[model samples]
Target: MLPQPNRQMALAQYRLRARFYDAELAAFEPVRLRSVGCLQLQPGNTVLDVGCGTGLSLELLHKGVGPQGQIVGIEQSPEMFDLARRRVARHKWRNVTLLNAPVASATIACQADAALFHFTHDILRHPDEVRHVVGHLKPGAHVAAAGLHWGAPWDWPTNWLVWMAAMYSTTSLEGLAQPWSHLLQHLGAVQLVPSPIHGVFIVCGKVLSTGSEVVHHV
Candidate 1:
C-alpha cells in the first residue's frame, strides 16, 4: 500500500522552506494564476484558500473578490503562517482571515462561494481534510486545484521532474498519478484544464448539491 501523508514531516519541511518559499515557488506563479482563475470569483464572494502558504496568491485572489469579498487562508506551519500573516498586515487587507490550523480542524465559519487548493498535494491526499474543506462550501460552490502529478508511464523525464519536486514539497508521493481523485469524488461535472507545464495538472469543478446528479472526472 502507498504511504499516507505525514503531518509532522510536512510541518518540518515547510518550517525550513518558509523563509524562501515565495522565491522557490516563483516559477509556478502562472500555475497559481490559472488555478485561481478557475474559481471565476466575483465581487462580494467569500473564498477559502486551502493550504495557503505565505499568501503568495492573496493579491490576485483579493483582486478577484474585491474589497467587499472575504478571504480565509488556512496554513498549518507556524513559520509559513507567520509570513502569511505579515503579508496581510503589510497590505492592510481587512477582509482577509488567517487560520493557523490544519484544514481538517480549522473552524471555517463561512459557507464559502469557492475554494482554491494550490499545490496542496498533502492536504488533497487526506480524505478527512478534503471532506472538512468541502463541507464548508455552499452547494454548487466552485473548487479549483493545481499541483504536480506523475506524467505518463513512459515519460521518464517528466516523471523524474515530478519526483524531485514532490520530494521537496509534498509529504507523500502516494496518489501523485491522480492527486485530485479524492477531491473530485465530492465534486460534480469536473473538468481538467490542460497544464502548460509537463507533469502538472489543473482541475476545476463545483460542489455537488444534495441529490444533484452530474458527471465527475479528474
Candidate 2:
C-alpha cells in the first residue's frame, strides 16, 4: 500500500501531466494502436481504462469495442479527468464516461468485460494496489496493459526517487515484461500472451470463470 502522502503526490503529477499528456504519449500513432489490437475486441464489451491519462487510450478502446461497447475511464487527478472529459466531449464519444478517482478506491459499480492500463503500472507505488485491482475483476474477463518498466534507461532511478520522496515508492519494475507477469499470475489469468510495444511490453490474459484455460491466439 502506498502512503497517503505519496498517493497525493502521484495524483499531483498526473494532474500536471494531463495538460500535455496527449502529445507526450502520442496516442494517435500506430504503435499505441497495435498495442491493443491482439485482443480482437468486438461490440457490447465493457472496457474500463484505469488511470486513463488525458484519455489517450479512450479513443482506441472506443474504436475497438465499437459503438455498442461501453468505455469507462477512471482517473485520480481532477485536472486529468477534466482534460479527458473535454477530449471525449470534443470527439463526441457518447459511450465513453470519465470518472475522477483512483483505481483502487474508485467504485466500478459493475464488473468489467475487459480492463485496460496504458503506462499506468510504473506509476503505481505499491504491489498490493495492483493486486487489489485484480481482486475486483470479474471472472472470464480480460485485461491488457502496456507500459515502460523500471530499467527503461530514462533516468528512471532519479524519477523514481523523486516520486518516492514525495511519500510513496514508485513501482519496483523488472524489465518491461515483469509487471504484467506479476499481476497476471497473482490474478490467476489464463492463456496469457506477451508482446512488445515500442518502449514497453504488453500482455493480454483472460480471467478464468472456473480456473480453466480458454483459447490460444497463436
Candidate 3:
C-alpha cells in the first residue's frame, strides 16, 4: 500500500498544471477512450467522472450517456474545475455537473450507473475516498481506473517514464507499483490491461452486491 498524499500539496500542484493539463494528457487519449469504453455506458445512465480534470473526457462520456444521462464530475482544484466548467459551457452540455470538492467529502446525491477514475492516482490511494464514491454507485455499476504504475524489472525505461510522470502528477511515490490495488478492494475482480505506453494500466470491474466476497489481487 502507498502512503496517503498531502491534499494541500496536491491542490497546489494541480493549480500550476491545470492550464496545460489537457495538452499534456493528449498522448493518453487512446487509453482514456478504452477505459471509458469499459464502462459500457447506456442512454439515461448517470456516470461519475472522479478527478475529472479540465473535463477532457466529458465529450466522450457525453457520447456514451447521451442527452438524457447525467454526468457528475467531482474535482478538488478550483483552477482545474474552472477550465472544466468552461469546457462544459463551451460545449453546451447541459447534463454535466461539476463539483469542486474532494471526493472524500463531496455530497454526491444520486447513485450512478458507472464511474471513471481516469489517471486519478491520488484519489485511488485513499480508501475512504474510494469507499465514499463507490458507496454511491448502483449495485453492479461499472467502474474503471487508469493510471501510471511501476513496470517489470526489465522495463526500466518504462519505469523511468512512470517516475517522471508521477513526480509531476502525484504527491506520493508509494503505490507506483500498482496504483489500482487499493481500488480493487471495492471493485472485486477487474480486468487489468497494460497499455503500450508502458507503466500505464486500465482496470475495469463492477461493484459487487453487499457482502459479496471480494476476489483479492495484487
Q: Give the winner by lDDT.
A: 1
- Tens digits of lDDT, candidate 3, 36-111: 9999999999999999989999999999999999999999999999999999999999999999999999999899
Model 1: per-residue lDDT, tens digit, 82-161?
A: 99999999999999999999999999999999999999999999999999999999999999999999999999999999
**Candidate 1 lDDT:** 0.95
Off by over 4 Å in 1: none
Q: Which regions in candidate 2 have their CA more than 4 angstroms from the true location?
A: 1-5, 122-125, 150-177, 186-199, 213-218
lDDT of 2 by residue, 1-218 (tens): 33222566667666566677677556435555655674557788888887787787787888888998988888878888888889898999899877787676777766777777666754343466566566666786777766554334576674464344222213333333354655655444433344333334565776656657545432
Error in Å for residue 32 of model 3? 0.2
Which order, best to worst by lDDT?
1, 3, 2
C-alpha local distance difference test of each model: 0.95, 0.63, 0.90
Higher-scoring candidate on lDDT, 2 or 3: 3
RMSD after Cα superposition, model 3: 1.6
Give the distance in Å from residue 22's predicted Cα in candidate 1 to where it truly belongs: 0.6
- Candidate 3 has its poorest 10 consecutive residues by lDDT at 188-197
TM-score of each: 0.98, 0.74, 0.95
lDDT score at residue 77, model 1, on the 0-100 scale: 98
